[model samples]
Target: MTKISQLDANDGRAELMTDEDVIARIFDHIDNGTTDRGQSSWKEPAVNYQSVDRLDAELALLRHRWIVFCPSSTLEKSGDYIARDAAGIPLIVVRGSDGEVRAFRNACRHRGVQVAKDEGCTSVFVCPYHGWSYGTDGSLRSVPNGDGFPGLEKETRGLVRVDCLEQAGLIFVRQNAGADRSESVPDMPDLIPDSFRVVKSEAMEIEANWKLHLESALEGYHIRSTHQTTFFPVQYDNLTVVEAFGENSRIAFPYQAIERLRGRPKTDWSANGRITYVYHLFPNVIISTFPDCMQVVVIEPLGLERTRQHMFLLTDCAEGGEVLEAVFKGQEFAAKGAIEDRDVVMSAQRGLKSGANDFLEFGLFESAIGRFHTVLKREIEIPAF
Candidate 1:
């Protein structure tokens, strides 16, 4: 239970466990033949995954929580913006000229049409349907006809504002306007450097429950079986350093090459090329740090049987060379592993109708997934506002 919150007290800027510290822990676990475990095993009802009512409840709960929309690197310049669906709400996250990040409902005030599409840079967002335009700060800047709507107050006709904050190189938006902004966000490791820049952005949909995809990233139990040719060759099987902080957690997958540091000086130890850290930013986002690049993954439920995944790759390299080569290689390796898990989760989703078991049992090795369900249940129980 070495939470990041306990690392330091710098106004929620707690230090992440250093590479030296994390490496030592991994070695200790390897020698002791034990991995982190939950207090107890947990079971979640199988029907919950398939029930429309449960899906609705979970989607509502997401609105009351701060959801990670994208990495700050994605919006590197003022007027840069990304528009997408998050928690079933169309959102536009833009960086204003003041160098502050802001979010607004994508729908235009005039015709309910989305003012922006996808990602780009623009000082103003114009509705294609009615020529209504809004500034990057979400102010209604102009209208198509000046005399048609004489009584229309432009001050209150701007795009709906959403609570957004850029912290620790990540952008988080609270969909519910009334949600207290002081609430805790994910306690993350300081992995994304200020030098990092977005290298690629991609989106895809999978025919599976979002939780199933999240569970795939939380445990290493399926590495040997599911990623035999992709990750198992370089990474150890079922060996991880798991730590929970607040409602978030980090699971480190150590590479076999870590044994090289066995007799080396502690000061020389580093996690750079020896491990991949998968951070479960509670509810629906995962940020994984690879050797050459880091990826931010946001999953949004598209339907009872579908989920959309937004993936953004960021790196400090700005030109093509060995650095860029390694970055793309890392991205490809991660994508392969993801596809393998996607296949398995889709099959699992299809299995929900089999009625084979009432509850899906999570073993000690899959404790992070168990913790996720526990936190989710608690949040969903508090009637959605």
Candidate 2:
């Protein structure tokens, strides 16, 4: 019955349970063989996964919402830029010389081709198709054949800007071209510190519905069965502490090592490395924190049955080499569990095609997934203004 809210709060930081408090809960769950549960079960229709209309509706909501683009550390340098697809729009998030982050449509104004590909540092972006160049602030700087089009207005023909916001050390972008600038954005909790730096980044397309990937991330019910070989040995199965924050939620998965803090003094305890904190940002961002490192996973829907995962490995850059080595080791362990989860979701996607069940039933332990579906349903039902 203990919650993180009971833990002492740090100045200007979210309240978190001390190691002693969390250890007590772990023991309680072990004895009772029960985890945090929801008030009721949820039944989700299969059409939500197979219907093109449903997918379109979900995409519409995502377009207007502030989805995570990347971590602020990814654009640490003044000219660093990351080019990727958000929902379906090709977006380029770049840091200007003034240390401000901005996002814009990646397409070149001359033609419809993308101007930037992948990520790198550059003072100016030169289009590979033509010689059109743009500054870090997204202003047109040069054009090769300027005289070819006499009526071309360089000032107004710069890159099309997208709505961008940076908060809590994360970068977010709204893909809707005409989205209201004054629209209220969901507040993001401080999940990672400013000192964290992106140590590695990976991009891959998964053969599963984006929701399926999110469901896998939101609960620990599948650890014993799905991740038995990878995670179950070191982590308890079907045990988690879920806390809701607006449209988002945080699921705490404790490691077996948490037992070591049972008799430790409360003031001397830390949750770092002893618990895996998975923050599910409304819609499609997953920020997972381990003792040594943090990861940001952006789930972008490619189609009804396909999704692109942008994974970034982050660690405290100010730490020493030994600390970094431990962080990298922890990241590898997490990566293994991720691979196992991917395989399970891909299998579920294939099974859904068999028309075996009309709906998928989510139990109480999977409450976070139910909460996500509720938010998605509410957003889709909103009338367009």
Candidate 3:
């Protein structure tokens, strides 16, 4: 029942309202016992979660669109590289000596075996299968035995390159080379400051659909019941300020302590410890802010019922014993909440297979989820073969 303004016209993103503006809106909703609502609700077919054909279409859409590969800070040095599977295709992102970031198909040009297995620093990637070496810039530097093949052109045999863009402290990779190569990365430099450093990272494979995990993060309607013992005591339930930025969205989850800012001057108010800003970058990236660090989660879909989640914890504190101690504590708190949410999503995935309903209903309180489905449906249209 709360009235919110439309997105900004210039940038296609919601305006970054001040702390005072957000706090006032939260209090207004609380006083009226109302929540934000979308233009309308949506009904998604349950089969969309279990159909193999649907999964294929979804993955195809992912390959053609721009997706976040990893945080730019992950590849900090010239030789640093992170390799992983994206949209079912193995990808390697490396920082070149010239300080430019680039992405390439992980497969070697000769035998197609992945040259880079995991994240590490290496001057050149030498394929384990055949000793074919490629430079950090993705050019084929050496083949074990040049005479084995006659008139081999190394320039034409370099590793296949994918479209890559480094923007706003994040690295984005388009899985397929021919997909629209235009650069449209969301502005995130201010949201993720340069001072921040990656302090910790962890990956998990979940037995659930990727979209289900993302839906859990998009709205706070389930916090009271699902995270009653973990987050409900500190953060409100079903209360969020959602804003759209092109295909992406930002949700503000305010803590109970936010009420303390009521008497402070608007200019003096800070969102640091009182509110958590969760930014969703289109297809499958989440950047969340905490008191002392930022948590970045990349949702990589493996199949209709499988997903790989890569999480990174970042902090900006000066190097010191106390700083390390605080960073660990912050990570621990974030991990606990993540575990709680994971359990909820896994259970939802299991229930969806029970044939209890033909369609999964999304109510007004879960408008963000509706918007996510809207975008997904628009992008996953099956083309004529």
Candidate 4:
């Protein structure tokens, strides 16, 4: 089995096993000849997420839309995320009796105290704050102090509610605690493609700015140096980048050159067609795809200098084998090289805060980074701050 990391350093683009270079060709060329590079912009990074301002809103959004995992449709099991409100108060997001979702502040109305944590199907939420209890629908069903407060209205005193929307297999919430659910619902897409679905995932904590870490995953310019021996770039490489919203971008690369140089088997994947996409959504979500697999990363900021990297891996391989090994080995090799990229960006974070390196650079080839910086500029603007 040949690995991408092991390729001849002397081999240049001219040596590609094409009709021009190869004494032979694998098959007849289609009318459209192959050359790599996707829709790319020539700009520098100026996105809003790069600054310290947008951090509060992004964190607020993540916590409000608590219990975001996979649909029971894919996992065949229930999983949820219960997190805190802006006031550091916990909230519960779970399936109710009708199998519909519900969001309730994990607090008691009678005496203003806390409720449950860690999710499971409970008929009702009995607040530990007081002997007060609430149904899954967030109704104040039982109260121990029935006579203590004669005028107390159970209807008026249920857990404080929050907003939620499930789209593209993601649960999103508003940053404000009392943000309207109807208004939030209006902005969300009602349907989602399975392509946006997820499989196995893990979360990792790191010492870095959230945008610094997220932006790191959106570009491939580092593949050549940082991933030299461990990935395709060391042997054969190229890039094609596309810009998204101001702070978001995507890059796609065809694996044909490495396949030819490494003498790997011809796959249905086109050397010149069927490009794989690496898309970065504004703020903190990214989806990186190869032909048979995709890894989505959702970032959570811990502080000014810390972030949690939650990665989800989806693959066509139902089980592992040598064939799967060949593909995922390429992925793991790529994954390891990310550490090298991380070292540089994390250091960049520490350096940028010093205000000396005020201006950053981007290349004509790095339009993706340029788009990223642009969007970040829009998101971080606050009238006061």
Number of the predicted model whose TM-score against the real structure is largest: 3
List clash counts for every candidate, in order. Answer: 0, 1, 0, 16
- Tens digits of per-residue lDDT, candidate 1, 116-152, equal 9999999999899989999999999999876999899
The lDDT leader among the candidates is 1
Q: Which pairs of residues have clashing backbones in candidate 1?
A: none
- Residues 168-285 of candidate 3 have per-residue lDDT tens digits of 8788888663535556654443567888888788899888999989988888888898888777899898898877766677888988888887777878677888889898877788
How far does residue 201 in candidate 2 sit from its true spot (Å)? 0.7
Q: How much does candidate 1 score in TM-score?
A: 0.92
lDDT of 4 by residue, 1-385 (tens): 1112111211122212322222112222211232223244433333333545556655544443332333322322233334333223466766666655656666777666766675455677777756688777778898785887888887888877766555555555443433323333222222234543444566676777776776666555665766666655432243542433223344554444434433433433343223445666554667666646667666667777787676666654454556466656656766676677678778877776676554566555555555555444433342222
For model 4, give the RMSD to the true fold.
10.3
Name the lDDT of candidate 4: 0.52
**lDDT per model vs. reference:** 0.84, 0.83, 0.82, 0.52
Question: How well does each candidate superpose onto the true structure, as a TM-score?
Answer: 0.92, 0.92, 0.93, 0.64
